[model samples]
Target: MPTSRPNILWISTHDINPHLGCYTGIWPGAEQASTPRLDALAADGLLFEQAFAAAPVCGPSRSAIITGCFPPAIGTMHMRTRATPPPEVRLLPEYFRAAGYWTGNTAFTDFQVDVPEPMYDELGDHTHWRLRDDPEQPFFMAFHSLITHESQIYLSDEEFAARTPDAQRVQKADVPPYHPDTEVYRTSWRRYLELISQMDHWVGTILDQLEEDGLADNTIVVFWSDHGLGMPRGKRWATELGFREPLIVRWPERIAPGSTYAEPVALMDLAPTMLAMCGLDVPGHMHGEVILGPDGRVQGRSEYVVSARDRMGEAEDTSRSIRDRRFRYTRHLHPDRSPMGHTEYPDNLWTWKELRRLFAQEAQQQLAFGEPPSILTDLQRSIVAASKRAPEELYDVRNDPHEEHNLAGLPGYADVQERLDSALDTWLAEVGDLGTRPERDLLARWRPDGRRPRAAEPEVDNRDGLVALTGTTDGSTIGWTTDPPTADRRRWQLYTAPFTPSAPIWVKTWRLGHEPSADVPIAAPAR
Candidate 1:
């Protein structure tokens, strides 16, 4: 391992399942994937075979990644709603900045909480580690790729042709049994695969830039996706396909080349793992435990990974999933509603329309994935029908990797169900499962009378030639800019330490959930 601190580069993608070229035979239904850059990356780095997201939806999943806490535990289980987190909790970047490292995020989105001001040294499309004033200082640079996002799966034909000319050859064999063979679905799936290829190109460009800047060798490159594929039963559901994520970490000094780890790992562990790699203390409040360090993988890592789902758009439901090595068990709290209950957002998807069509055909004794008389499989019916969902589902992932068969009802897996059920009960109690508290109650607490609490205005004091700024607000971070502030609020610098100002500066105090105080100006001290 290197003696000095290593720069960490985090690259996150959206709505992707493990269909990489490297996983050709390993992960079924992705044998045709062509990804040279990612293949090379896997050859030179550590590829985690069983990485899963804390939540299936993008917003809630991202909330878990940024906070290093499960959505249910942190009051961020809802899909797109914003709520206040506990005061003691801090975003991942804050830890890097506090450790005297330059932090930059090319694209920043923490949908769980309303972050009043930019916390990183740089944020936005042009943000980069090179922008840091001190070249010697270590950095944590993060960025995201939207090429493989949900919306891209059903691009306009003209747009799709521009990106992928050969995107219409997908067949029934390429798709799982859950989906019926249809032209619209075939096209959407083809486009999704091609986008994954393009996303690899995007990743290559960033890595190329890192090497061009001579930071590759000393930098730890971590690549991951927020969640899995964005099909009908993919992104929002708590199924195996929905929660699976691709994780690759390349740090040649410490991580062995071409190595692979098959242990189940949650995306929430990312923040603490990064901190551990950087030799920093992992905060006690974080729900994730560090999984890797200088000595490689942690001993006695977590046995099971848990995920959550709640109120996706207008769809109202709550479900929790627990996965051990060979099985995944899902318990739907609201069994009255079908797992296929419509959410306006995903209902627009072509695949969702296809699923609905299949559901109607099956009702008329017409739909089939394989051949005539096969009819709709139980998995397909469960996914597309408006019928009530089973209270619980258990899948033997080792035997049925697609999770088509539910073992919860079967008598043989009694021990498995009991063990997983107990584990889930224990976890819920330990975390206090803030999700049990009504979202309305949480909203009321976060925003009284539908208005955010405001932080006290920041005050600046001149100590000799140094400028010291503070606000009476108990726990607030400050953001400052010059008199003629730039239109882009992201340019505001965080006030972490006293500074000798070159010109007059403006400052404001901001807490996570509170409204930032009005900008107050401070004159430059005498030279």
Candidate 2:
């Protein structure tokens, strides 16, 4: 390894919990035992057995990871609600960039946070790492994999069959008790496991490339998921399954191989941990503490980790949760609202659709007149009760790992509940959680127009054989796509410098919290 700063490779996958073979001890039967690459990676690194995300959803969770602060505290907790960070805030990559480290990130959904140009030397696909001008410079690269995303579960039957020829279908009896035991639910579970296997292959490819390039030993590879699975009572809930993540860190020169840490840690700590590992100071503004210090030794364990949830898609709600080694406590600010409220994203899931069908069928059975009553099964009734939760909940996680029983009002758990509630109150106050306020109020204060700020049109200048693209909007980043302006945001290229185009293309610009500019056609330069 180089005597100077070590190279950092951060790999993130979408929507998964610690459902690998290693975590089977914690979540028995959750593992499909199919991720050999990740299993091997775990054996060669330090595994964090109790890592959790600051939020259950992607945008808010990633915001916390990048900023080392709670998303709600930084005004970035809501999904698809983009905003520029406050002037006082400094992102993690910006600090690395200032420390002479080259920073880059592959395709990511920055739906809630705006990454300024100075924060990254490269922002595009995985090739950005190779495109760096100085190969010897210490680099911080983040690669995101979307194969395990929730949308993968929405694959058509033919697509699912085509992808999983050898995959084993999970039995309906293996489905968690929280969900109904049905073929639809079983199919969804099996499909998710199949995706996990496929994701492992993609992860293996990156690891193989690092080794083939002879950079594996010098690079500190960190692998983790953004949040939890995108199923009912997950992703948006403040439960253990929603926030817990699988984290593996490998640094052959520093960290001991095949070690495990059981301490409770939040994803926010990653930014500070990376800075500390690179022999840099943890910024005072960062809310997270360094879990791994400069000497590559374990720091003091976090007594508890806190997580929060706000608006998701169109449904608005607020929740805060605190989890210790033995217990998980959650407080829902809007207990009156059902968890089944219309959220467009999750509603697309086949399991969610099946649940909705059952809910509607049960509701129809309860006629107003003297009709013979058709009753819901115990599992269905439990689902309904969970949809409309109590204002406060307390779970003895050690005794009820699945978190099925609520101990908030239970007589023996009063003291436990009070202690956790106090801890949560202190955390909320310290972090300045804005989730306590209404979504509309926050929007009005931040964006009075009730819409994202608009960006100015991009100007294209053709000089000789080169094409230069500029945007009139200050602080906005320019991007171009061969496809239409409304093309997938992931397909657009982050514009940094002028280039000669092989063909005519469309250009657009966007700023955080702003609507993207209309696409402008750029004709190819004539000879």
Candidate 3:
């Protein structure tokens, strides 16, 4: 018999926060979210209790998983992607392609290429794994479920009317106290859960096809979400829900059935592990590491894993985070701005309407009691503002899972706060993150011309403590750090170059016009 390499299937859903029975241990329905497929998949493989996406938002987070690098490291901190991967930066699929595995992406490929115009294939339905059933070739396929996308407009009036109030109650059952308890809010939750059910059905269909093709045993299946639910205190930060993902890794030959690993793991760690499991090189550019030894023993890393968020959708400069399973600490340069919505992006509009109704209800109750309307707490107000965020936030995950408490200034935890802050600061300095706004300003200054160069855009490569900026309006150019930037460099790097799929460009320290640079040879500077 010929030696066989396991085929890989990666399935991702948008904005799901591990609400499935397999991860949350609480399903929406009386029997739990009806997910026979995912439950079966979990039974066959290893389940990761503490897994995180690279970033909390979609575009940037997805990019990090594919490339095994940070969003800022690649100048892709912005949530919406107009940047293309440089020729030198190979995505995971491309690597598999090089290794002779047929690769297919069904739903989304946030990474773009150098084509001058959008390819004719661009308009086709997102890539599907069904295309990868070729028996002659080993394959890698990725599919994303998008019905859970963050938007209140996902429901029809008829659908909302048809749902029983009891059915809708579960949506609000998981609601955090900080948010209002109202029917509008409750109804929104119902719609969202319905979408989750739809996603479950999709998973079932895919699983059936895999079995029919006799690829079930030969394939290593991985199912996860890009981030948490599209709700407040989720998706865009280092909170448990934001980073905690639903991971079902099934490879029966290598992994025993009904196995669960509580050891905290970063999603970035998955890339390296996959490469190692496939018996391929974990490229030098990848910052992630494999958790399991070749002998199949678990070789875990630190007690804590770091999660980062910058700008996304419309959100602006934020900061990196460090969490040690119990506590999360973050440091922000923009103290005045609400960390969440400084660069606001329209979010679940349905939730917004629900909040408005809550506000009205609260006010009416206050008047009926001949009392003043309760003023919103800082945290509650921030949740309602949608775009509001704070420069600094600290939470003890054990006591406050919703991240409602910001303990940055609580006197009792001074020592813990100092330790976390110091650690976070040191990591930023070592990683060459001058700070979000400052880096933005530098990239903008380097690209003075309205247009950025598309062909030679700077990519996230750490070489000699200097990064490069390429594809200037005048052609290939350079940007470098004469001195490593401090917290003052956070500003948006504006350029005229169209942030299109074809004409890629970026802002960084090394100049492409100058002598070429090499990858940063050491691990990122420690905080």
TM-score of each: 0.93, 0.83, 0.74
The superposed Cα distance between candidate 3 and the true structure at residue 336, in angstroms, equals 2.0
Candidate 3: how many backbone clashes?
43
Which candidate has the top score in lDDT? Answer: 1
Error of 3 at 169 (Å): 11
Expressed as tens digits, the lDDT of each residue in 376-452 for candidate 1 is 66767788667678899999887898887789977799999999999998988887687767888888888888998
lDDT of 3 by residue, 145-240 (tens): 676676532457765444322232233444456555555546555666666666776787788888998788877788988887776556675556
Off by over 4 Å in 3: 1-3, 25-32, 84-88, 111-134, 159-173, 293-297, 339-348, 356-379, 385-391, 434-449, 452-527
lDDT of model 1, residue 457: 91
lDDT of 3 at 239: 59
lDDT of 2 at 258: 86
User: On TM-score, who's better, 1 or 2?
Assistant: 1
The TM-score, computed over Cα atoms with residue i paired to residue i, of candidate 2 is 0.83
State which candidate has the highest TM-score: 1
Candidate 1 Cα misplacement greater than 4 A, ranges: 108-110, 116-118, 165-173, 295-299, 365-375, 459-462, 465-475, 483-490
Residues 85-184 of candidate 2: C-alpha lDDT, one tens digit per residue: 5545556776777677888898684637666444576777754567678888888999998888988788898977676555445444267777777888
Cand. 3 Cα-lDDT: 0.60
Which candidate do you rate higher for lDDT, 2 or 3?
2
Could you tell which candidate, 1 or 2, scores higher by lDDT? 1
